[model samples]
Target: MAKVSISLDAELVVEVMVLAGIGSPQDAIEAVVRDYVVRGHRTEARTELKDRNLREVDAKPQEPQG
Candidate 1:
C-alpha cells in the first residue's frame, strides 16, 4: 500500500488518541482516512443515482400524436 503524509493540530491529535485509545498517531490518521474514503464513495454513488434518475425522467416518452 502507498503511504501519505498529513499534518494535524496538536489538540486534535491528543483528542483522537484519547477517544480511540490508539497507540500511534498514524493509526488514528488511518482510521480518519478510511472513514473519509467510505463516506466519499457513498456520496459519489448517491450523485450517480440522482443523475441517472434525471436522465430517465428526461428520456420519458411524450404523448402519442393524434
Candidate 2:
C-alpha cells in the first residue's frame, strides 16, 4: 500500500476515532476510504450493466375497460 498524507478537520477526526474505537486517525481514514472506494466501484458496475442493455420492461398500457 502506498503512503499518502491528507489534512482533516480536528473535530471530524475526533468524531471518527470515537465512532471507530480506533486509537489513530490513520485507521479511521483508511476504513472510510476503503468503504468509499468499494461503494464507488459497485455503483460504476451497476452503471455498466445499464449501459449493456438491461432494458426496463414497462407493462403495456391497458385499454380503458368498457
Candidate 3:
C-alpha cells in the first residue's frame, strides 16, 4: 500500500464520508477512487462491444418432458 498526502475540502470530505458510509477519510477517498476506476472500465467495455456490434444473448435452457 502506498501512502499519499492530499489536501481536500472539509465539506467534500464529509460528503464523501457520508456517501461511502465510512468514518475514515482514507477509506472514503479509496472508495470513491475505486468506484471511479470501475466505472471507467465498464464504459470502455461497452464501447468495445458496441464497436463490434455485439449484443448480449439470453440463453435459457428449456426443460423437455416426455
Candidate 4:
C-alpha cells in the first residue's frame, strides 16, 4: 500500500467519514476512489457492447445455403 498526503476540506472529510461508516479519513477516501474506478470500468464495457451491436445491425445479411 502507498501512503498519500493530501489536503481535503475538513468538513467534507468529517462528512465522508460519517457517510461511509469508516473510522479513518484515509479509509473513506480509498473507498470512494474504488467505487469511482469500478463504475468507470462498467460504463466503458457497456459502451463497447452497444457500439458492437449497432455495427452488427448495420451490416448486410447473407443468404441462407441450401
Q: Name the lDDT of candidate 2.
A: 0.84
Residue 61's lDDT in candidate 3: 52
Worst 10 residues of 1 by lDDT: 14-23
RMSD to the native, candidate 3?
A: 9.3
Tens digit of lDDT per residue, candidate 4, span 2-65? 7879999999999999999999998998898899999999999999999999999879697888
Q: Which candidate comes out best when scored by TM-score?
A: 4
Residue runs of model 3 more than 4 Å from their true location after superposition? 54-66
TM-score of decoy 2: 0.68
lDDT of 3 by residue, 1-66 (tens): 978899999999999999889999989999999999999999999999886664333344558879
Q: Which residue ranges in model 4 land beyond 4 Å of their true spot?
A: 61-66
Q: Spell out the clash pairs found in candidate 1.
A: none
lDDT of 4 at 33: 87
> Least lDDT summed over 10 consecutive residues: which range in candidate 4?
56-65
Which scores better on lDDT, 2 or 3? 3
How large an RMSD does model 4 have? Answer: 4.7
Model 4, residue 30: distance off in Å is 0.5
What would the per-residue lDDT of candidate 2 be over residues 1-66, giving only the tens digit for each residue?
788888989999989889888889999878878889999999999998876654443344557897
TM-score to native of every candidate shown: 0.73, 0.68, 0.72, 0.79
